[model samples]
Target: MERKVPTGIYGLDELIGGGFRNNSVNMIFGGTGVGKTTFSMQFINYGLNRGEKGIYISMEMTEEQIIRESKQIGWGEIEKHIEKGRLRIIHTHGEDIVILSRFLQDIEEEIGEEEVRLAIDPLTPIIYNVQQKRHRKTISEFFNGLRRFGTSVVTLEEMEGVEMMPLYLADSVIKLQSLGYGERYDRTLRIVKYRGGKHGEGLYPFSIERGLGIVVDVTEEQINRVTPKMKYREYFEDAKRKIRQVEGELREALLNKIEALETSWTRDESPERVLQMFFRTELGREI
Candidate 1:
């Protein structure tokens, strides 16, 4: 398997073959309030937390505004990362392609060959600022420049014709939709295209939560893979029986924890390994 740069969005990496391909450009497009900026922030913040350097180039927001929004969403350590020189935020006007090109060149020279994560919130303005006849040349050059910075997550506003160019050019394209149905503000994410990888094909339900950013609901397929062909309850039956030997309130607590695991465990560990660890550590006996 090729090395991947995890997007750091919960439940998203699994859907995109571990994560975005290393050094690839990924596009995230959505309408207003569909959490596009939050998605970009989460990707950069994920790298920053891991001590990996990140650069955020914002055409829509100022440095102060971006920092304030990051803190409001519970990413309070963003300022510290900036102070430590692990992360940088550049605020620029998108319409000036000449100036933006110079900034990108300077960034590339400074970053050199280091593996860094780059985030461009709402790349629409830059693309839209160019003449229609020059879009191909302009977008190609822009995306090529971004690839030099290692892995990148670029956000785009989903206008009727504005997205087709970027969507076609990106290594992987993720579409975020705001499905306004009645009183609910339901949102979904779909993998529009992945150049060289298999990806989830359906609309994945997701929610934007405080501190968590975008939380994707784990599909039944993801949960079921932990125990192939075997139901979780049947796989853990022997472990449950072992828990019966555990007496008092501890017994009930153990059983409840097991029940929770049966429904909520989405990791790659097999049920046998999980149950073995559970019995060995919790009950002090092998099942």
Candidate 2:
């Protein structure tokens, strides 16, 4: 129960109890404008400032683009880490996996290398890399390789379905959400899931301020919070059970409506009659 990786995002740190457990892959999922990339960068930049070696492999933007933004985000010192061999920013196309695998191999060979932080910004492009042929085995191998690298890691994942793959592999998961539907937008973030650590399910509001960095305000009121090291299986099972009951009730109601509509005894379908028919047919009540 050693608390490590401590994200340093005040409220988030308290909720997740330190930070993401060491040597794990974490999915940070959200829509395009939700600032998933920025959050990932912030996490990586924080690690870099601590002199922890890190590799930020990005498919969406080049190394220079992220570095430039890092400077604008008040992390210009990250460039010094890159020069000191404590950080590496790589941009890859279809062959990113191969390149990253080789890089990991090199780090393995290096004698006396410090613990690394690996951030693969927006893991969505990997789908296109293998042309959707990537299976569970390949994905598990991907995560396994990361853990083998022996570092604290967070992988940004752009997902289609809310149920995504890397979440199953990662020791933690943070989901970034946004305000505004269209052009005008503001960013919000939440920890959607985590394994082997405590994390809150409630949405914690965050903002990227020019002077303050990624500040998380816990609100003046006490918000609902989950236990650190909460039982993952139990929570998920309870959630599934609730959803199943809801679905069954919805289906039953639909069937009853169809049956009532088909009955010749039906007239205007009044509120009272509908209630009466529902009780009589479903609950065995009198006409």
Candidate 3:
């Protein structure tokens, strides 16, 4: 079996055969306000929490804007991760293809042999800046460089009639669609392709929550059938209050994780079991 890198988004891993294939380049395309950036950030944050490094290269937003927006969506540890050398964020500001290529080389050198997760938000700037004749070569080289950094998730804006070359180069492709029908199921996710693994078929309903980035509504009926009825929100709140008792950085990290769980806790296991696991992993102690 191929080594899998777990995507931090709740309920997404099980759909893509336990996460993305290790060292593979994945592409996510979506229209505006369709949760593409959130998906990429969640992938990077997931790696950072597990002691893996991450690099976020943004062509649109600045470092300050990214940090502020991330905190607004409940990823409080992004600044802390950067301070501790676990994460690095770069803003290209629509730089040319040459400068972007140089940035990738410098990152590869800095990472050395350590595996790192990479996120490039809206790759349209870099790829579209080049000539049409060079699109194939540029995309091929760019995808190859991303693979060296371990696993990567790159986002692209969904244009009406434009053909995206990255879609063909990527090992996996996930397309996020916004139906705009103003219903509960306005947004949906579809796995367009997974090179070597079987993935869930059909469009899955999803929502972009405040704390939780993108929660894919998969396996809800199965979880409901197996798990007993309980007040998940009440239990999550109690855990949050307890987490507030701790001081300093650990407290902030714990609270962030708990808040995300509060928004998308749909597992078959009880919340108490999940809380215990968090305590043991983060605090190195039993609750």
Candidate 4:
């Protein structure tokens, strides 16, 4: 079998069975601040590092803005790659078919020389120009043109669970979400589907740090860190098991509190504190 294209995002490659298939289009859907842009940039940079040319087509951000954001996230060498002609970043402000066609033309021409890693950030704007029925046909043809050169990744905005037009067209789909549970937000990444590849299912908690970018934890222990329900349930189970050792009305009261544990409490307060509070109050001692 041919080798797959590495995304360069740690832990993600393993989920999709050793990265993406070459000459394939992968769809990445995420809401605001869910690290879609950063991930795409990282993918391009990774390809560049491996001595492969890359092209980043943006419908929203300028070249200067992309360079600035990439630098902030420790991907400062983007400019250097561009300088060496190993990378190309294009911001297509065009909204119509003709303009989009021209943008595709540039990409086709660039990829003619060598195998390149391509990223189309927020592919929504380009495809949204046409009607819904025409969207599938138009977008499909556009992506088909891209595949003749190299593998590509297209980022899209999640439309509140609505069926996106691009999701059906891409070879692989990666969905990202940021849920505000507890005192702060928890980010998650899930592989929706990877055609002809074995992928891990379910939401895996991920963090977007400054230098690290996006890192996902597939292990049970690491997953428990950001999984509120799982983490709290473990805490509840431990307390429940221990509470059984105590006798009489005190134990009964603790049981009631455990059953009464609300989602808000699990999120706002620490689960360990719930048991500690009961111990301190009933036992007349701090734990």
Model 1 residue 181 CA deviation in Å:
2.6
Candidate 1 residue runs with Cα over 4 Å from true position:
99-103, 160-163, 182-185, 222-287
| Per-residue lDDT over 76-130 for candidate 1, one digit per residue giving the tens place of the 0 to 100 score | 9999999998888888877766545675787787576788999988788777776
Query: Where is the poorest 10-residue window by lDDT in model 3?
Result: 221-230
What is candidate 4's CA lDDT for residue 111?
Answer: 68
**Model 3 lDDT tens row, 242-267:** 88988898898888888766544545
lDDT string for model 4 (52-101, tens) is 99999888899999999988988888899999999999887537445555
Candidate 4 C-alpha error for residue 159, in Å = 2.5
Prediction RMSDs, each to the true structure? 12.5, 13.6, 14.5, 14.9
61-80: candidate 2 lDDT, tens digit per residue: 88789878888877888779
Which residue pairs show collisions in model 3?
A: none
TM-score of each: 0.74, 0.67, 0.74, 0.72
Ranking by TM-score: 1, 3, 4, 2
C-alpha lDDT of all candidate models, in order:
0.82, 0.62, 0.83, 0.78
Better of 3 and 4 by TM-score: 3
Minimum summed lDDT over a 10-residue window in model 1 is located at 223-232
Report how far off residue 245 is in candidate 2 (Å). Answer: 45
